[model samples]
Target: MIAISDPIRIEPWNFAPERSNFPTRNLPNRRAEIAREKQLTTLIRENNRSRRTCASKIAEMAKKAGIEVKPLEIEFIAARAGIAIS
Candidate 1:
């Protein structure tokens, strides 16, 4: 018989790379960019409707599979669906 004491051990590594020296491009006009952002927001909202439906289906499937789902997981799914949970 083997006694299991520690489940796992972790070691930290410092692997950060130095920043690049590439020159950035000039951004577009603020007003035009704002308009584009609004359009993107609308598109994201519309897409999230379908995503929410998918999330609900996934939750149902998880329940059927006997997997325990936490409220935080549900909230994360809701956030991805663009549905605010507060």
Candidate 2:
């Protein structure tokens, strides 16, 4: 027969990743790019327009609204949003 003095042991976790050996990521911020993609998606769905037309329209509107947006940025947004570039 075996006799155990203490059967259970409990330890508290601090949950500090910085203190522990956890790897941290240093990723770039892409909020603006993501926001632009969402806007492009909405515009495409609303008008059922092609990439070129949408890009031109967005550029014109941005120009009128005093926002500096380039045509290439629009193309990238369309591409990121999975819209067909025509």
Query: Over the stretch 1-86, how does candidate 1's per-residue lDDT look in tens digits?
Result: 76688577664343323222321322344455556445434433444554544544544555565644544565464565466434
lDDT of 2 by residue, 1-86 (tens): 77687687764564554333333331223455456667656755444464446566776666676766776776676677677655
Q: How does each model score on TM-score? A: 0.28, 0.43
Clashing pairs in 1: none
CA-RMSD of model 1: 13.7
Best by lDDT: 2
Best by TM-score: 2
Model 2 global lDDT (CA atoms, 0 to 1)? 0.60
